[model samples]
Target: MKKLIEVDHVSNERVSNVHFSLMEGSLTTIIGPSGAGKSSLLLLLNRLEDPDKGEIHFKGKKISDFPISELRRNIGMVFQQAHLFDGTVEENLKFGPSLRKKWEQNDGVKLLEKVQLSEEFLTKEVENLSGGEQQRVAFARTLANNPEVLLLDEVTSALDMRTVELMEELLHKLVKEEGKTILMITHDLKQAKRLGSYTLFMNEGKVEEQGETASLFQHPKTAALKHFFEG
Candidate 1:
């Protein structure tokens, strides 16, 4: 498969000299201890934060080469917090496509359905929704833009078990069927192993080890990774 994203010796306040590549249509997970720069790495990838050194390339072009609006539109991100606007679900779902002058009334409903939310949710207020419901909306809003790559920062951390499972199922469909590339930061080791085909194990601001998910988890090459699995 072609490389979708390439990070070369990238560094910032949090990440240190990290280098890796995410293959097209692959589901990869970033696993590490807290403060390991996992979230910071995501920020740098989408230009939410620029690296102090090195560079990032997406689909063979430097990320800096793309216009900020275009880059963000194609490389979308969803954070742990829902971060929804103060409005009804329909409004939030329409935000991205509307900004790009591509909005259609049916788009919101379809996007909601993709995230397993029904059409009735379109009229409901975001603030009134439960944490899981709000998260699904946030995800649906991101999907409204129809991005090629998704950078998820612990998006399921606060969700209940049932909702988390549903979100995971949706993510699998996205990769297996929709053919989007994904790199997710996850604190749950089991979720990482189960959800991702490839895994990057990070610690102390660097990717200490990376390989196929099962192999990396079963036989950690670095001491930091071994200690992480043990802990």
Candidate 2:
């Protein structure tokens, strides 16, 4: 597979000398304890926060070379808390694409279906929806941008188990059918193992270990990783 984003010695106040490549159309889970900089690392991916040192390349081109607006449009982010605007679900879905003059009449409906929500949700008030439904709307809104890569920061942390499972299923479908690349930060190791093909284990702002999820979980190479699994 082609490399989508390449990180070389990237660092910030919270994230340290991290190096990795996210392959196209792959879901890579970043797992670590709290304050290990998992969320900090994700911020740098979409230029939500820039690395104080090192470089990030998108599709073999320097990330800085791309316009920030366009870059963020291509790389969408979904946070743990779904922050919806004070409006209907359709308005939330149309927000991003409208800014770029790419909004379509049916975009909202299409995105809702993609996230496994029905058409009726389009007219529902975002604030009236349950947490899970709101999150699904958030995902659909992000998808409306037609992003190539998605940066998910503990998106399912506040969700119920069933909602989390549904989100995982939707994510897998997105990867398989749409070939969207995903880099997700998840504290749940079990969720990582279930959804991720590759996993990055981090600690104290550094990458402790990384490899295929099955191999790394089955045979942790470092004491830290072993302890994490054992714990």
Candidate 3:
């Protein structure tokens, strides 16, 4: 796998000395308590927000070398809340590719299936759909672009147990089938281990512990994560 992004000696207003290298076409979970700068890390990758100091390279090139619009298009993001436009479901899904004429009907339908939604959802209005349904639509829209990386910011937080489980199952399959390089941030340890092959545990704006998901959980490296579980 290629090293898509390298967070080298990064120091921001929120975090300092955060360094890590993320591989392409692999799922990496950023696990931490709230305010650990995990979301900040994701922002750096997409260049939505820039870092104060350090080098962030993508595909062996500096992140700044890539055009912001083009970089964002290639890295699809799913927020905690599904920010759908005030339109029909079909219209919302068509928003991105409508301008570029890149996304297709088959791609939309395939993404809908990946998110475990029926074709009937395409016609429904966004306002009428439930939270879970809306998020499924958002996930479908993200996949519409065939992004190399998927940044999920607490994607399952507001979802019900049933829906979260369903989406997790679908994401697991998508990673293997599509070779998606996924970076997901979650407070839920169970969900992280289930979804991530590798996990990084952050505390006080630092990566205190990190390892394979199974090993890290079973044998935590830092008192922070240990206390987190014991408490």
lDDT of each: 0.94, 0.91, 0.83
* Per-candidate alpha-carbon RMSD to the true structure: 0.7, 1.0, 1.5
Q: List TM-score per model, in order.
A: 0.99, 0.97, 0.94
Instruction: Compute the lDDT for candidate 2.
Output: 0.91
For candidate 3, report its TM-score: 0.94
Model 1: how far residue 197 lies from native, Å? 0.7
- Give residue 13's lDDT in candidate 3 (0 to 100): 76
Cα lDDT tens digits for candidate 3, 1-231 = 778878888878776678887788778899888898888878877788888999888788887898877787778888888999998888888777776887676666666777888888888899999999998898888777777888899989989999999988877776888778888998787888888888888877788887888899899978899987775
**Tens digits of lDDT, candidate 1, 1-231:** 899999999999999999999999999999999999999999999899999999899989999999999999899999889999999999999999998789997898899889899999999999899999998999999989999999999999999999999999999999999999999999999999899999998899999999999999888888889889889
Residue 202 local lDDT, model 3: 80
Q: How well is each residue in 1-231 modelled by candidate 2, as lDDT tens digits?
A: 999999999999998999999999999999988899988888888898999999999999989999998999899999888899998999899999999788888888889888788999999999899998998898888888889999998989888989898899999998999999999999898999999999999999998899999999899999999888877
| Model 2 bad stretches (over 4 Å) | none
Model 1 lDDT on a 0 to 1 scale: 0.94
lDDT of 3 at 192: 89
Pairs clashing in candidate 3?
Answer: none
